[model samples]
Target chain A: MSVSAASSRLPGTVAIGRRRVSVELKQFFRDRNSAVFNFAFPMVLLVIFGSVFGGQEVAPGISFAQYFVAGMIASGVLYTSFQNLAIAIPLEREDGTLKRLQGTPMPKASYFIGKAATVFVTYGAQVVILVAVGVAFYDIRLPSTALQWFTFLWASVLGLIACTLCGLAFSVVPKTGRGASAVVTPIVLVLQFTSGVFFVFTQLPQWMQVFSSLFPLKWLAQAMRSVFLPDSAAAGEVSGSWELGLCAGMLALWCVIGLVLALVFFRWTKQGTT
Target chain B: MSVRDVRKSYGDLHALDGATFSIEMGECFALLGPNGAGKTTITEILEGYRRRDSGEAQVLGIDPARGDRVWRSQLGIVLQTDRDLGDLTVAEAVRHFAGYYPDPRDPDDVIDSVGLTSKRRSRNEKLSGGQRRRLDVALGLIGRPRVLFLDEPTTGFDPEARREFWTLIDGLKAEGTTILLTTHYLEEAQHLADRVAVISRGRVLACDTPDRLGGRERSSARVSWIEDGVRVETQTMSPTTVVLELAQRLGGDVPGLEVHRETLEDIYLSMLDDDRDEEAGESA
Candidate 1:
């Protein structure tokens, strides 16, 4: 019986996961300041970026609010995946919190599952909040059909996977807590800005636009826009089925890469390999 | 539990260089070392956390490098660092881990054993330093592991807390649980270990009963007594024989006489000094 197998026989994965969720929620939203960070901060950024931008030119016709809403939610993936995972994962590793858990017969998968689950559920709520604000304050419309909402959800999931993978890879190089934010911050900032979440990619210089397409951020934002915005309008950033397939494929590839790094570097003892 | 010539390296650094040791069923074995002495490397290999670079290791009849469900089920590990549940109470945390093992002890019983029953409902992060250490032991023992590994189990404890923790470990020893412990504190090693091994720089210097290592038992002892109201002292190879002679001269209890040989700590410190001298010599 392997460690994972031994852990499989245990019933505490879901129970522990539930406990971890309750604990994280309280810790992350314990105060008024935290509430601002978790909820209002992102909405404020959306407003600032959405209004201040000069209008974009797109071949497909769409409402500006519809286009901007998806981009805002893609930014939510940025908040949930890269920024969120980077801070939490490095802190856990530095304080030896993860080391302590590894010795227990707890299934290792539950740790990742618990973390990703919290991010997904919390960010899910944040997405609703962002969308609600978009509708109430910015006149953004709801998807006209169920299919569009489903597509938006699927695209968000892909973006989450890709960004999380990148975060995990980036976490490997940050050996200490104080230095970790410095290492992960620049990459996150550049990726977030270039991915077209804050602005349209085509309007950038041609060379910069080419560089942005290589990252999952642009593809994810592009895919997300395809879902939430009406196809009849030519106002969206991404154009065809080929771009959507490429985004999904690239995100899946990054998932494999992230999981591999996480497994190899995982430590569960007083002495850590990392 | 047996580990044979296990070796591990961290890039150019050799963390565990052919380290080999084991604890029989129901035995208490202590590993002693400084900060970077590879004690952790060897113990981690036994815990199935880090991969061994070379050689075979068996923990509870399974190779830890490939320990299975039953293998993992039979062993428990207590890390040097404490775990965080943030808001989960002590009882809740212990109960949570108890669900992971097939033959786990009762959560309440384990909590009481570690002297954390009063703090059972208190959030883990709210516990005092000693209280948290007790909670750490409670989680380790919850699984009723056949072999328990305790790494520097009581580093931040006060004198009273340390004594209480020792009593708890003695209770575990009485139950036939094998304990493999690593510690930096010499007094801690002397107090709890049935036998001790001193290692430095990725190698084991010696392994024996506390009184037997490094020619410890046969070394000359210091005898002190008040003779005719004047304090007198002498050194002798045999503490018991000296005491007997003093008894004969005094015609009874040997008038304030005491024969004291070097303690386990004395032996341990000498070993450490030897290590420093060797390093200095090599550099010179």
Candidate 2:
């Protein structure tokens, strides 16, 4: 059928990309445990961190709870986007679902869109969880100004995109679902630690901080912290500028590279791998 | 329909090497081959699933290699794997997929045609294996496809179900739907195919009517009969002449006489064996 005519009744479009997204969403909700892990695991991590560092101070100025809340929220950016992609993409590729869809008239890019859509929803859930827990337990207040909230919101969203791109890129290398955790878990933990997802970036060594800056994690964390914490508090977090625009630029660059790698190298079959 | 000199490979392994074949507008062409003999690669190429390194192939006057989206709407593919629709009833999944086609068969009619009406409302995952196969056939047909490619369509089917599937295929053939079946079941090919092609090592060894395949039908008829408490048999091209001579000798009809012609399976297995022996000798 003509693409136009074929899309006539497409739930979105019969494009393989749209089909992939829909099926992912369908299966995502069907597996209650999967949804729980995607949406709830971060909160569980939040509780653990919150209780452990409840009264202690990470720095002379920053309360452990305050610092870790933002760090945990930033980790949501990785957990929601990266964790989802790492688990879903390789599993789908292994299960022959990708191979099955290749036979259709759906374009290759459509599959990516489907994957991105699921990550987007999962991230949305993570955002709600992060904000709810931060406010309820840790006193991690929302920005006083709407503009600050917008900054936090946009920064958080951008972080998700960046991590998602990295995740999709990461998924292309794992040969099987078992290897997926091995491939994704380590890089995620490294990025998490270096990006200040679990600790204060300022306390790390100068070279370590520089290396962290090279990644989008630190940028996303710094930008997000600027909104979630008081303006007075962020003064101790980064430099005068913190290169906010450069942070966006670098993240966008990773987004482009990750996307390109995902598009080019991702194999739906073991045909070549085998 | 034509697939001209197509070559497809995955990594170091060549799947199809300049494989060429064609089917007419209203012909049932059976692709007979042992497992992993490149029948699937060729079919996938025709279905516009896999890209070939070199070839010019066409289905219904449109080149499958470059067939646009509209061309695919006219085709149907029955996969070996069944659909995985958990909650949706048989009618629901069929109705859902039917919406994708520009011209879809009525879901109810397709269900009935596949003999699934009694279980139409039941959830798809609850159906028996045979019923599920019927559902797959129904889904393949719901698109009102012009050229239906059935890959091992009757697989996992019991004897009765196999016969029913053949009848369904014949019904589709009567409706002028050009059916292409790739099967290991020689009986299925003998019963359903108007022309059968035996493929080995990514090449077509022979393509002809089942009756004429390997000269099985016209080569000779083997006749066995009872005479004087003993059984006698003769192999001759002219069975009627041999029967007449035997009748004269016995002074009546040959008792317990039976004439046998080689089955498609016999010829196919022998052809495959010969190809293997030749390969062995050449390797040695």
Candidate 3:
């Protein structure tokens, strides 16, 4: 037999992908900055916001702190899953890490799946911590029924997937690792404010409300509100209803579009000519 | 592996005009060139990292441009720049890369072979530049590749580190690994490569064994000696005849006699100079 034929067979794609996820998670934990930003920063935001606005009432019965908890959770999902990936992917591409992995036998799909898996794990843990903080210190209530819990589960899963996919799609915007923060930070800030993460949605101007609705952040915030807030608290929302169906549909649409864009534009190297 | 009439261009710049070469299995072939000579363009095309505009590149009996994961698994690559998996220890990094291969060498053994056994527990970020390079080699070798592509592998290495790297490469050659190396270091080419291809401006100027490159073996030799306390030097097509004549004239051994031939560096530089002059003439 020829030398090539004599060599061992290539491993399965899923097996290598699992290894890539393990390796990526190991590296993620080692980066203390990312650890704090993805896992701890959201809980800190929850405490700060809950303390300042916990007394004010958003509706007849629900307090502003209770309403803000759902928004904060939505912002946490976007920050950990989307904003983090937007910056990290570009940085990795600039530093030649993506190129190195491309040269390996591991499939490109596996590389992306590994990154998505890391986001899910880290962001999932952050969600758990935020829920604990909301319940323990802030008098925030959990979903009382199995049906509400199911709604919460699907919203969280779909929201995470949508934001993470958008992050991957935006990875090509930054020219270098140093520029990633400059490109992503302003967008995240604008999204948080316009989506009513801090202010009441009904208080924002109609134009700003329409503008925010163009992106996924507002819908994600609405989705979380549907799960966490009592049904009467919907009066404070832009439409006086949760619009849970619309929220899920928008998130799923963004997921499809983002997945397609990422697959098309994702780069292994910083420059096209090289 | 063979590359024939390969052509690649970036806008108006021809990164690879037309490069052609081949490597026999188990032979160490060096692509010797200066910076921006298209050595990287050729190497990347063969590695399947980049595509060629027009050419035939067959690596391990398969076209690299269309090669699959199975084809990729058979080749090892040590890039010019460092690949950062800096958070992991040396052993962890090596073992992680090992998982990508079908049948990989033991990670511990690979690390030891690269002389990084002592640094196995150290994080990649903490290792020095030379040590990082050794780790790169270890990662490349763990795949147990039949062919290895090393692009300027010792560019930033210290003299001691360079020599040590040469020893490690020698061991790989002895184990029958086909190595395709590119470097501007002529001495490295002379020491390690069984055959050398001199490239300049996206073109192959000449390809031959290091000793016979540019017809150096048949070229004139420089004979230097001391006569009447004065040093004299002359170039001769036959150094033996010159030496005999000098011995007869001196009636004994010539004082401070030395015979010098064209070194690999001398021939390589002159070849590049000649190519540049020819291009200048053509453009004029």
Give the clash count for each candidate. Answer: 11, 6, 0
lDDT of each: 0.75, 0.76, 0.86
Summing lDDT over every window of 10 consecutive residues in candidate 3 chain B, give the lowest-scoring window. B65-74
User: A217-240 in candidate 3: lDDT tens per residue?
Assistant: 899888888788887777777777
Query: What does DockQ give for each predicted structure?
Result: 0.32, 0.19, 0.55
The docking category that best describes candidate 2 is incorrect
**What TM-score does model 2 achieve against the real structure?**
0.85
lDDT of 3 at A94: 65
lDDT of 2 by residue, B54-123 (tens): 8788887876767755666678887777545544678876776675566788999999988899998897
Q: What is the TM-score of chain B alone in each candidate?
A: 0.94, 0.95, 0.94
Task: Write model 1 residue lDDT over A28-120, tens digit each, in one string.
Answer: 554344357557878887676556641343344444556667777877787777777776677677776777666766666666666777677
What is the iRMS for every candidate structure? 3.8, 4.7, 2.5
Candidate 3: list runs displaced more than 4 Å: A1-8, A271-274, B225-234, B240-257
Pairwise DockQ winner, candidates 1 and 3: 3
Number of the top lDDT candidate: 3
